[model samples]
Target: MEETSITAEPGKQEIVISRVFDAPPDLVFKACTDPELISRWWAPESITTTVEKMDTRPGGMWRVTQRDAEGNEYAFHGVYHEVTPERIVDTFEYEAMPGHVLLETETIEDLGGGRTKMTDHLIFQSVEDRDGMLQSGMEEEMTGPMERLAELLQSLKQAAPAR
Candidate 1:
């Protein structure tokens, strides 16, 4: 299991999460941008997630909704500012919070020999918002999805036929 590194500097409005995967950059990028692949690992095992819309190009919109056992749905939608195999920039807004939007930049760094490092940088609108997110158990909640992503990537690599 890979440990996720989360850096949250006091008084700053940003949180950066980083993790390394045993898969190449292309594979990691595909898993993130593909709606089908995203649904498989975007949420925890106990939560059911559906990718309502996913447009990978710039100025596109994406939305995903997650339903829990009690029928509560949590929806998140974002607009893509930039999209590339190596980097993605988007605006993320949780539906419940209305106007609390954050900009996210995810970079997939190829480390050679079939390994890649994914770094997600999130900049909140304010320091209070950033601190609120940290206090909301966001760090713990993120681990599940990341672990699932790693597992899904491994499965994808094994399923791919020899080149």
Candidate 2:
């Protein structure tokens, strides 16, 4: 399994998270845009994720909720500015933080030979907000979901029926 890499430069309000997956670009793209597929691997193993709304198109909106073992809920909602097979741009805001919105752009690269690389570029409103996100166990939360995503991708690939 490829490990996730998260980079956040000091004094900057940007973060870049990336990982390689052992699947094709189309499959990766589908896994990302499909709400059902998203809920399957969008959260940590200890949490349950529900896709409250998802409309993969420009000017569309999306909402997701995650519940932990203790039943604590975390809700996130966003608006899609752009959506395509290879790229997606959206605004992400956690309901708990109200107005701390961040712009996120995810790109899916076809690395050839049944491999794909997914990269997320996130820009926060300010350095403080970016630092707060980094300090809030964001890396673990991101990594856990990524690992789950890899597993899901592998299963989907295997289930493709010799095509």
Candidate 3:
């Protein structure tokens, strides 16, 4: 149960988050790029997720919507500008804050011994926008989903047949 490591430099328009999971790169990558697996662990416990669309290829598009317990829906959409076995590059935009787009790059590093490391770099349009997101409780918002992802990975590993 290691914590996700995060780095946010002052005056920079980016945030980086890193974590290791007890799974191989292929399985970890599938958990991220697959819509069904994403829906299982991409939202906080208080929210239910719906995968509107996902196309994990260069120029492909993806969208996800989440509904809170209060019945309020939140949506996010992005385009896949780059995709590979170990890295993904995409643009992310929250519907409520239109025009405030951010570029996200996620990298998966094989850590050996049945483990993989994931790092997400989120680049905002400006430092102000990045600060705004941080102020909006971005870390808190991500903590649960990340923990859920770890749990889901463990479950998936258990379900697989012996190699």
Candidate 4:
């Protein structure tokens, strides 16, 4: 699997992360939208997540809370703008910091040969907001969870009997 990230507008504050996973697109998509799977790998190892509500359809809303090791809780809420088997677009807001919103789009494509490519594009309201998120350690926060997902996928494959 290959991964790459780029900041489309360093000044305007847009972040994009692309990753190729050794899994089918449908499986990858399910890992993203399924609450159970989400909770299993949505945050870093030191954090625990609780899904307050999840409605995964266009115009539906999802709310989740993350509790850090220090017992501090952060809440995230989002309204789905578009929802399809292969793509999802949403508006996200951090309840802890109201008025700071982000528009996020996730696309999953089948790369064939049991591989999938997933791209996540995040747009902040302003460059400041984007910088603030980065400064707050967003990238580090995501790394562990993503690694966990990879491990989970590996385990799934290992447990499956041959053909």
- Give the top-scoring candidate (lDDT): 2
Residue 144 CA displacement from its true place in model 4, Å? 2.0
- Best-to-worst order by TM-score is 2, 3, 1, 4
* Pairs with backbone N, CA or C atoms under 3 Å apart (clashes), candidate 2: none
lDDT values, one for every candidate: 0.95, 0.96, 0.93, 0.83
- 111 Cα displacement, candidate 3 (Å): 0.6
C-alpha RMSD in Å of predicted model 2 compared with the true structure: 0.7
Tens digits of per-residue lDDT, candidate 2, 1-163, equal: 5999999999999999999999999999999999999999998899999999999999999999999999999999999999998999999999999999999999999999999999999999999999999999999999999999999999999999775
lDDT of 1: 0.95
Model 4 residue 24 CA deviation (Å) reads 0.4
Residue range 43-96, candidate 1, lDDT tens digits: 888899999999999999999999999999999999999999999999999999
Order of candidates by lDDT, top first?
2, 1, 3, 4
**Candidate with more favorable, higher lDDT: 2 or 4:** 2
Instruction: Return the lDDT, model 3, position 107.
Output: 98
Taking all chains together, each candidate's TM-score versus the true structure is 0.98, 0.98, 0.98, 0.91
The sequence of per-residue lDDT tens digits that candidate 4 reaches over residues 47-113 is: 8988888899989999999998889999999999998878999998999899999999999998898
lDDT of 3 by residue, 12-109 (tens): 99999989998889888999999999999998888999999999999999999999999999999999999888999999999999999999999999
